[model samples]
Target: MQIKRNTALMVGVLLILAVAAWAVTRPAKPRLAAPTAIPVRVVSVAQQDVPRFISGIGSVLSLHSVVIRPQIDGILTQLLVKEGQSVKAGDLLATIDDRSIRASLDQARAQLGESQAQLQVALVNLKRYKALSIDDGVSKQTYDQQQALVNQLKATAQGNQAAIDAAQVQLSYTQIRSPVSGRVGIRNVDEGNFLRMSDTQGLFTVTQLDPIAVEFSLPQQMLPTLQGLIAAPTRATVDAYLGADTDNQTGDLLGEGHLSLIDNQISSTTGTLRAKAEFSNPAHKLWPGQLVTIKVQTALDKNALVVPPTVVQRGLDSHFVYRVSADKVEVVPVQVAYQNSDINIIKGVQAGDVLVSDGQSRLKAGAQVEVLKEPPQVIHTANAQVQP
Candidate 1:
């Protein structure tokens, strides 16, 4: 019994030592630390009126572009206007060889005078024949013959007058004039060159610079929207840029214009509708045949809940935003009503709500957040005031 007690005590001691060793060496139940807030950039939602725009590729076109061609085939005797000269309608651009034309005109005038004198003499004789025929003093055949001579002379005079008018018209063509008010392009045929009516190329081109038109094409789906713009009470505004940036936030703005017209039919192959906008290009910034990007304002959203584009995140099913509650952010699903490069109009958040603008990649639902910087002052419509 003593031996068994000693063995039992030894076994109990060994068990106690093992327990003590484990108590000393094993890790204390890990002390829990509060979750750290994720660092993020945040911005407050703003309420403002925002304009919605649609972009398209466009080409600048002159409203009035004319090719200065010779109406009559003749020698290009004189070039009065220099290249790149601004001219008005009816301004003399050049002169043709008018020697032949003048000669023909002078001959026609002389013929007209001679015919008038002959007609005058025939009329006097007809009067005398009528008086003698009234008493049967002259034969009926003689009186008839005199009257016929008078009629022949009258016809000759009328023919001569028409010839004179034709000559005058031919003479006026010798002085080539600008048909439109515009700037003259580079000349093809110089002075002293023989020009023809059938010449494929003309002397030069005159392109109207001010109040130019821009031709653009949009998808056929936007036809209804464009029609609304055209029928709007106020003219819809448009902007032209250098590159085809659809957001229209980049590149230099070339000119501003108003929506002019939409094409009668859409292009069957491209499935796009052609549209035009007219811009007041007094500075000549918009040139003919230059390719540009166009933005047309389709509508304006009043009191829109605006936020930075980065604030909205695109998820697999729908878009979402991180709405900060206290130190934590909740993923709030949002619908982007209208969006541009700078701002996005969202539907789920209020004007005073704070949103995560950056550092979204490290975020999730109910994630703790640390705002990196204070948001900018929210500029309200009536007065610029910070949102609480």
Candidate 2:
């Protein structure tokens, strides 16, 4: 009986061991099967001859503006211009009281009269002496003395005349005029305020609005391309807009402008070169210190393989994109030429290749995808890129 019981116990222990072995070795419950299709939006990559563009933020500035101030000092008497009023060059903007200056001018005129009378008397005496000396009628010493007196009196009269002219000029300076045709800023000094020549405080400011400058900066890497663009016999042109929201609201298309200036040195910290373009602000839409966006072509890549910007994807170290293939979504490595909001100019992608555009966040290598029936509109190309 004992032997039979021990045999049964041994069999039960062997059975338990076999079951544990099977549990450990069994394949993970066959992973829940993948869905039959993945919903996605796709775009057909095309080599739409895209003009290369470099983009940067810039500030609008008036072509010529300066703070108007008095060159000569006096009590501020009249402010001739109102704030925000348009003024033309040489227009009187303000005036200082010139009562004292007028008096000084009169005094100089009196001095000039006195010197002239003295000169006339000396001339008469010199003439008389010259007549007397002609036939040894007067001593040589007397004639020489009379001639010297005449010359001295003449010099005194000229000096007095110069003083009078200087006084008149000072009186004219009491009326300050606009140096440029532009809108006038707020007036700092009112009537009865004392002004001084040494004071640098501005009485008002004038800024030209019809034509303006848009200042921007580009990376140093673009220098070679910019040089190439410049070397082309036909200079490129660029357009500047005022309103950031809509191109239409910005005003009559500010006329096209050309590359005006480039900085000699690159910024140490940012590695960028400053640049400027002059655009006609016909409607006065561009203003001083207004922030703006600019699109400029630093270089153009001929026959570049381009794709929609939305198709480009950020992977680990390199930028990759999803190329729709027969079997599944295939990850493609691409070299980017440039990127804008709607499209990207790239080097690796080719024409007619279907690229995954909308659904990429959850995509992985070899992930199956389905293209939505709706297609996106393409941005048509026209107008050669101008250097502005």
Candidate 3:
């Protein structure tokens, strides 16, 4: 039994030794394949003149707006202008019932005529009295009494003439005329409606459409910059957009104008300053009380280095961009001088340097990159040009 045990142990040891020798002699596993190059889009840096603008919300206003009101209390007999009709200053807008005014004027004229007839008689009597007093044909007391009576009649004639003048002046107010040149708004009173001079709501409104104005507010910190523009020889230009979107990529432009005025005091609660601009609105596109976006060009930077806004990346400590060179990308730090919705003005990168615009997540320092070329745009041509 002992001899059999020793033989079995020797066989087991030899089998283990053979297995270890095979494991040591085997070939090593193949190395992992290298990572594929990341696909990216790149754009070359560009240098150009950039404009710096201050943006704010603005409201459209009319340069001349007036509420048409009746000067005298009377029934509105006729409306000469329809709603939304353009009219010039002093144009007939509406007519009030003038029959009552005309009658009052006639009465005043009749009173003046009666007074003049009496004054004529008084003049003749005064001449007779003077002759009698000179010749002593009558008593001095009687002549003096006649003279005083003539003077009283003359004063009554003057008072009647003054009443006639006042009546004529009031008659002129019966015709309602436009106070300014503008388009008419909705009517507050219709024909046959009695209007009063003290009515809070006027008959209608007229607002000047051409050469309109826009009011806007900006932060007080920008006051110095705005003052500089105002002090310049040429007036600074202002642009108004339709919507509140200040982003140039999406906002629609309404019109352009020149800076007109600035409020003397700033609002303490909001820390903002108010300003106004005047625009020639021949098309009447801008309306009163319309909210819009305004851009005021305050300064211009000559020969600024610009890049696509997407190329810039924010980091923990600073901003960065992946600069492409020789099919490799390197993380380059950049200082952003100014930025708009579309592009950014940078100072760290030089002009003509290529930058990666997309696919930045898989990038590392000195990482290999595959630049993607954009598909060519298809253009349509006229048949005549194509034939040639």
Candidate 4:
């Protein structure tokens, strides 16, 4: 019994020693620190042609407009043109009853014919009188009187011819014709209505619709830039847009044309300058008094440094962006050249700098960052890793 007890004690002591050795000499397990994932979004920077532009609201107008009226006092016998019909220059638009004027012209012509015949007879008599005077057969007073009668008859014939010409002109005035090539508006007078040359009101209106003009105003600050653009030898083009509202901006391409006119004085109320641009309007999609938005390319900077607009951020007094440097965020201030939709043309952002597109809002001056081995497709948080 004593030997067994001593053997049992020895085994227990050996097991205890083994436990003590494990407690003293076993390799220490490492303590792991939790990882921090910052939420963010990212987009790669690319080089593209950035256009400089000026945007403004404008209204369309007709370059030429005129009121059509009658030139003779007569009844409206026939209407030759319909409302909204396109007419060419000298096209017959309306006709009036010309019976009185025509009868008067016929009477004058008849009188001219009679006067010419009388003048011929007087000339023959004067010739005979001259022959008689040379032979001393007729008295000098009788020859002189015959010559004076011939002169008087010739003058009367000329005056009658003049009256016939004037009467014919008056008869021609009964037909009203289009003075310009344009679209006709509503007709104010119908057939059988008496019209007079002295009528102060117009019978109809015609507007030259094709090749329309779009009038727009630009801020006074844009004058310098516009002058510089105009000074260049090459002519610049402008585009016009029309839509239901400002949001649903639809651009109807009124074909490109030259800048026709610029107002001499600036508007004091709006602090803007008025300008006019002409369009080809081949399809006639543009009309008079149509509202539109104007976009003009002012200039192009060939050497401008540019980046995505999403990377730009506002600083206290200027704009800045966060760039990746040695696995850390570096905020840099940038002077912007201009913004074209999704891209921004800048002066300070370099070509090779890795810009933090989404995490810029959360980044401090220097924050440690790790580029994920597999970039996330969707980043919801502010400090998440952003993919380039």
Candidate 5:
């Protein structure tokens, strides 16, 4: 029994030593620290004149589009204008074979001459018969008959003259002319081809490109604002842009114009109203049927709070911005009044408030931020006079 008790005490002591060693030598549990600040670029909110614009996709249209067709039926003898040639009004386009018309005119003139000669003879005979009847040299009925012959010959000559005039008018139709000043499109018929007045496919087309127009549609809700602009003494300004960016935020400017017209009726099916603007396309950049982006300036705000569009973030319920305050960023909800690719006119943010433009993906509410760079400050100086 004494030996057993000694062995039990030894085992107990070894167990206690193992437990104490484990308690002293085990690795320490790591404690986590707060997240580090994110580096970001920021810009201060600003107050400036912000113009409100309505945007839409539009198509360029020519001021005048006409198909040049022959007015008479004949073989084309002359092709005066080439394809894609710029022409002015009354320019010769083509000429048809006018030989038939000329021949007919000559025939009518010959008939008129013959009739006139016969009428002269009848008048001479009638004068002789009147003198003879006064002296009772021939019957009164015979003199009256001679007078009727003169009248009949006179009527025939007038009819022949009318025919000559008609032939001359028809001859003029053989000379084809451009009714409008424009550029000629593709030619439908070559020289030596026969053309008819009833031909559906015309000789070519003439499209007026300069001072072009753009047609676009806007939502019906904008009708009132558009009406107000139309009622103003001065026309509203419009801008057309080329290809849009990947995000469709903006595009390269193509040209500027003024509002020209608005459709009388709105499209019930599409819930949109059609509008048109005219641009002085001297450079001929805008082509007919080409698609473009259009912006119509409907109104202007003199003093509006604005910020860079990149600083605004879209959330599930509202748009927000990470406003920087003393090295900390807080979530700020903003109401966007208007937005273009460059700037956003917003509410709920004051001027001089700094907002994060980049590195917002790494931020949350109450997160810390490190400003990478400050925006450049502008200094205005008064005009100075130079001394001689």
Candidate 6:
């Protein structure tokens, strides 16, 4: 039994030694290593004339707007214009019942005719009396009385003529015409509706479409800049944007305008000053009471260091940027001179300096950077090699 156990132990030791030799002699497997450089996209700083603009919410207003109302009390017999129709000044818009006014005018005319006929007869009688008195053929008192009678008839005819003029004025008021060249708004009263001269609500409104105005409000801090623009011989250009856009740099552009005027006083409650700009809206892109976004150019920074907004990052204390130097990046504190939604005018970076625009989340000061201007290089590590 001792001889069999010794033989088995010797065989196990030999097998263990063989397995150790095989493990040591085999080829090592490929292993993974950490990336040496962080992948990032970069941009170069540019020097150019950057226009500085201030943005505000604005409302569109028609330069010429009028509420068409009747001058005389009457029934609106006919409406000659449809809603939203463009009309010129003096274009007939609506008609009132004019039969009563016409009748009054005709009666005044007949009264004037009768009075004039009587006056003509009186004048002829006075002429005859004067001739008779010249020869002493008639009494002087009779000629004087005839002259007085003629004067009285002339007064009656003059009063009747005045009445005819008054009636004619009333007749003209029956035709309601457009007082301004514009587009008509919705009608407040329909045809056959009784209209009173004292009614505050009128038939409709006429608002000028072309050569419109936009009213905007800016903070009082921009007052000086606005004053300079208004006093300039050439008005400052303004741009209006549509919804979700705060400046001319983004979104849909509605129309262009020029600064017209500024309000005399700033609002104490809001700390903002109101301003107005004019635009020739021949296409009717701007309408009355339309809300829009306005961008008013305050100044132009010549040869400004311009960069993408994303290049500048806001830290807990101040703003900073990742400036690329060779293969490494360093954080550089930057001062923003002016910034809009599209670009930023900064002070710390020089023109033509390279900056890391993206992949900043994984980057730190003094970290290596691999510029991702092109596709990343692919490395195919050799599969784990084993040699017998």
User: Which regions of candidate 5 deviate over 4 angstroms?
Assistant: 1-19, 25-40, 107-162, 245-252, 313-320, 329-333, 340-342, 359-368, 374-388
The best candidate in terms of TM-score: 1
**Residue 47, model 4, lDDT:** 48
Q: Indicate the TM-score of model 3.
A: 0.82
Clashes of each: 0, 4, 0, 5, 0, 0
lDDT of 4 by residue, 1-388 (tens): 9999999999999999999999999999988977464555554444444455566788899888889878778899999999999998899988889899889888888888998898899889888988988989899999999888888888888888898889888877888888888999988888989898888777898899877898999888877766766677876666777763222235555556556667888999989998888888877877888888776666555644556567789888999887777677777898876664445667676665667776665678777766554463331211111111
Encode model 6's per-residue lDDT on 1-388: one tens digit a residue. 9999999999999999999999999999978887699999888888877566677899999888999899999999999999989999999999999999899889989998998999999999999998999899899999999999998988999999899999989999999899889999998999889999999998999999899999999989888889999998877988877773552344567799899999999999999999999998888888789899887876666787877778899999989999999999999999987765567778987988888888999989999999987653221111101110
Task: Tell me the deviation in Å of residue 355 in model 2.
Answer: 4.6
Error of 4 at 302 (Å): 3.1
lDDT score, candidate 5, position 1: 100
Please report, in order, the local distance difference test score of every candidate based on alpha carbons.
Answer: 0.87, 0.76, 0.84, 0.75, 0.86, 0.85
lDDT of 3 by residue, 1-388 (tens): 9999999999999999999999999999999999788999888788777676778899999999999888899999999999999999999998888898889889988988988898788778778878888889878898788788778887887888888888888888888898889999998888999899999899899999998999999988888888888889999988888874665525667888989898999999999999999998988888999988888877777777877778899999999999998989999999988775567778788888989888998898899999999952221111001000
Cα displacement (angstroms), candidate 1, residue 4, comes to 13
lDDT at position 226, candidate 4: 69
Candidate No. with top lDDT: 1
Distance from true location, Cα of 59 in model 2, Å: 2.9
Candidate 3 residue 178 C-alpha distance from true site, Å: 0.5
Predicted structure 5: lDDT: 0.86
TM-score of each: 0.88, 0.73, 0.82, 0.76, 0.75, 0.75
Model 4: lDDT equals: 0.75
Positional deviation of residue 235's Cα in model 4 after best superposition, in angstroms: 3.2
231-278: candidate 2 lDDT, tens digit per residue: 777665555544433211233334467666776788999998888888
Q: Distance from true position, residue 119, model 3, in Å?
A: 4.7
